[model samples]
Target: MKEKLLTKEDLAEDHKKAVRGNTKTTREDWLAEAQRVLIEEGVDRVKVDRLANKLNVTRGGFYWFFKNRQDLLDILLANWKDSKNDPLTHTLKGKNKTPLDPLVRFIFTTIRERSYSPALDSAMRDWARTSNKTRRAVDLVDNRRISVLAKVYQGLGYEEEEAFIRARIQYFHQVGYYAMGVHESHEQRLHYLPIYFKQLTGFDLPKEALQGFMEE
Candidate 1:
């Protein structure tokens, strides 16, 4: 997943189709499953026949929703980026969140949840190195999200560059933690998430940062 190889026109068109679901199929649900596959399995693993089998639907059923595998991926990335990010935006708008602390929570909470697939994370890391188109898309997606994050951080007094750099480092931190998280239990891994996140960004990540969210 991670915004691997795709064209802008292709992404826009696919985004439209997913957003405009008709009665012939449940476009959102199908796209949700596709996103799960991409996030959990990698962009290349979004096989039409396999998805068809997994959904207990026919290949024809999938075709009704997507023109092909590429189309499915385009929609999946668009939707995931759109949906998974709403909560972060909400936190940004609310007065309750602390400077940079919400950002750390967004990063480490994803690690705690295993939101992205290990298989897919590896694929995209390699893909970004070799595929020009994919690297560009990755850059766009990464920068686009970071830019929004930068805005939030700047409001808290970080200069623009500082905010972006913080977002970038924290982004990589979440990805790295996800790739290596299998070694620990959920509670154990989450225990150090706040401090580890702060270290990545060279920021004053709040001590007892997550105290309110945890139960004794």
Candidate 2:
């Protein structure tokens, strides 16, 4: 029998299969898996071999992207800090074209969309209990969040003292809800959102904005 050569189409199809079988994992993939482990199993469980096994890939995949385990952990911490602060800063820096704009944006973005991670937040707080470095990171995130929230209230015509207090009330309420594992569905919480906003700011959030949250 004569030797046979593959056609271009056959070669291309083989290449596709090879690529599909060995999917390229990025730094985000490793970080995401590590974060999941950190949240579920705590920081001690975020080791490279452990994560690699969980991700169903060899440790080489992790080493290729990270200098070492500490480097990967540092990146994860940085991501947590950004995830905590950025969205709050963005949402609170509102033009407030309407009386309810800032409050509505803050509620919608922070509460409903929940752009940050509660599990990660709780995990980080637990980690902070032992590590001063982690504690400082948590402090920075908390201070920035509360300060920005205070500024939002100040913008809503609250005095500096009242603004800070109201900010604490709102922020602490949220932290307590997460800490206590209180679960309220959107439907259950819907009627109370505007009421909470009003009590927090001493001003009614517009009916339209209230409706927006209810509809969700």
Candidate 3:
């Protein structure tokens, strides 16, 4: 007998079976996929079935890690609020650093490394429009971030109220920069860094501040 050729349906069924048999999928795997979906599409599209399809695993695997879809969503929101993983928080925690190091590192991480994802931030903000709980979470995160930025200004000798206002200006400017969907190349943004620094901080960006970034 001639060897039988598998049809497309057969191949798909085989794939389903293979995924169903998979036991290696972890909670982090599911969350990562959900986060990607949340950023690329929207929160509404972050369904369990949809994520299982993207991850090439059975939906059963998801239940092993989460109680339900809401559980996953709650975890996602919690992860966003976790300051230990936040780049801005991490940058501010540096020891024996210059007064301006936090600001410089904040700019570098946000622009160069993209550790603070604008797309993810925009997605969470969009989600906030529909969910009051998410709105509160976003508000909390925003306030915390702004407070950290304010301290950077305070370290530079600005008074409390002035530091708060300046921090809002700097933080809101970056948030709006992404929200407005402004397109600028890395080099173009880099070229404007000193000007933006001066405008936001009321002090010229020192040449040495651009030290490590320029060589990269």
Instruction: Report clashes for each candidate as comma-separated counts.
Output: 3, 0, 0
- Lowest summed lDDT across 10 adjacent residues in model 2 is found at 11-20
lDDT per residue, candidate 1, 46-127, as tens digits? 7766665666554555555576777877665454345354444444445545666556556544554444344554555555
Give the lDDT of residue 109 in candidate 2.
Answer: 71
Model 2 segments beyond 4 Å from truth? 1-20, 83-85
Order of candidate numbers by lDDT, starting with the best: 3, 2, 1
**Candidate 2 structure quality by residue, lDDT tens digits, 150-209:** 888887788999999998898888778789987788766776777887787788878887
Candidate that scores best on TM-score: 3
Name the candidate, 1 or 3, with the larger lDDT value. 3
Checking candidate 3 for backbone clashes, the offending pairs are none
Give lDDT: candidate 1, residue 122. Answer: 56
Q: CA lDDT, every prediction?
A: 0.60, 0.75, 0.83
How many clashes would you count in candidate 2? 0
Model 3: lDDT of residue 155? 89
